[model samples]
Target: MSRLRPEAGILPPVSSPIAQQASFGERLRALRQARKMTLQQASKETGVAQSTLSKMENNQLSPTFNLMQKLALGLGIDMPQLFAPVHEARISGRRSVTKKQQGREHLTATYEHELLATELDSKRMVPFKSRVRARHLDEFGGWVRHEGEELLLVLEGDVLVYTEEYEPLPLSEGDSTYFDSTMGHAVVSVSKDDALVLWVCVAQ
Candidate 1:
């Protein structure tokens, strides 16, 4: 059965106790149509075929993980949020983050951090910790940006951050700086030793 919320386009795939039996395909089709988009339009945006999407929506074909990922991204939904349980539809106004417990997502890096926050359901400020390497310096690439002004503090060791115009500024442990993040900026290790810093970015 196809179910559509007035504003929500997706449905529970199946009525399983754990997994929602909602149809990603049907939701995709309905969402596309609701957005005044054609199958061809969705295909252009998601790189999935119109026929494939049609088949999946009609339950003739089951969407693979990759297909659902593409569909979720096209629909502007987080992968996990899209497949969230029916019983727990929206987590908003339900719980609060405690001081000892902050929601976090971690990736392959040197240390721990409270990663990017949920967009609309998130707090204003986001914090991330960059830990230095003990063996050698990080293969310096550049600073990652989202939307914010950042104040970076050298929590430990030495750090050098450079903007496109000015030369790299070296800051020792306990030193800190605040700057506009619109410009192209990158961070590197100033010393042959490690460099760890705490970054607090305020959302706009």
Candidate 2:
């Protein structure tokens, strides 16, 4: 699987459930075509090089966190829409059920993420399960920062959370931490095995 940029690594491999619905390149192409946008127009709107956008649309390039944010903002859609297909319209009383190990998987060097409830569109909260794979800070190029607040609950083993503005905090199974997602943060497993956590990010 091709990995995303080091700062916010995540890529849906061919075997991942999310890839079954649509590849990132296919989704990008669809969105651009739906908007009647040419590659030049998309590049201008996204502040990305035209060649880069072309490569992305052709599945020859994986986006970084910064690129994803720019694409979302430029395309007038939320970040999750980059990975999951969106419903045609929003409606009331909507719900989606995900069976065990059935959530859309996005793998990264530092974390293996399973995005939950991806069938719904325009969600206020994005929930996912992550397996902490990094054991050291150097594994990440920089902190992963984004809009909104985040809640992380340790599911198994132990983790050490690092934030740009605070000392490292250790968390055990059943423990959790909530913080501003904009502060820049990363988590590493400190246990014998990789740790698991339920992470919920409140979108703005």
Candidate 3:
């Protein structure tokens, strides 16, 4: 199991169905090789360091959502394609049940993402149960804007949502907000400890 840096915290051991079958690094490597591209080429195109790309391919690093999105764009594919294992066809009417502590994990500087519903490909939305880590806006290097819409439902503690067009908004447990993903936004924990949220974003 790969992990992020110390400040970002360690990723939970994955118990998700997807992780049991394949790894993010393995899939990423396969995609890279399939296009006859080298790590240097990918790094140049994606603006990600070659060492980081190598670590990701070697399963020594866990990529952030933004990093994964950049890799997808560099590979000339959509984000969903990165999660899909080659030669595995999409199963229609797919149903999945992810128990607590049982989803594929990806740790980032700001949040820990547990990706859910990986069994189905060509999905319109991707859901994650995330743990907010960063306590201040300065912790995030910049705004995060992506294609689609996103909904965040706070499950624990307090969180502050910062948007490009609006002032910082505070949310408590059981509060939820839906916003355009294209808008620059970031969420930070305001609680004394950690905060949890169920985030669902539509596919680009």
Candidate 2 vs candidate 3: the TM-score winner is 2
After superposition, candidate 1 runs with Cα above 4 Å error: 1-105, 108-121, 133-143
Evaluated at residue 198, the lDDT of candidate 2 is 95
Top model number, lDDT:
2
In model 1, the number of clashes is 7
lDDT of 2 by residue, 149-199 (tens): 989999999999998788899999999999998787889999989999999
User: What would the per-residue lDDT of candidate 3 be over residues 53-113, giving only the tens digit for each residue?
Assistant: 8877776676666676678778876565676653355666667677888776666768877
Per-residue lDDT for 105-159 in model 1, tens only? 2222323333333332333454556654423223322233333478889987887
Error of 3 at 64 (Å): 3.0
Model 2 whole-model lDDT (C-alpha atoms): 0.80
Candidate 2: pairs in clash? none
* Displacement of the residue 45 alpha carbon in candidate 2, Å: 3.5
**Candidate 2 stretches greater than 4 Å from native:** 1-22, 47-52, 64-69
Candidate order (TM-score) = 2, 3, 1
Considering TM-score, which of the candidate structures 1 and 3 is the better prediction for this target?
3
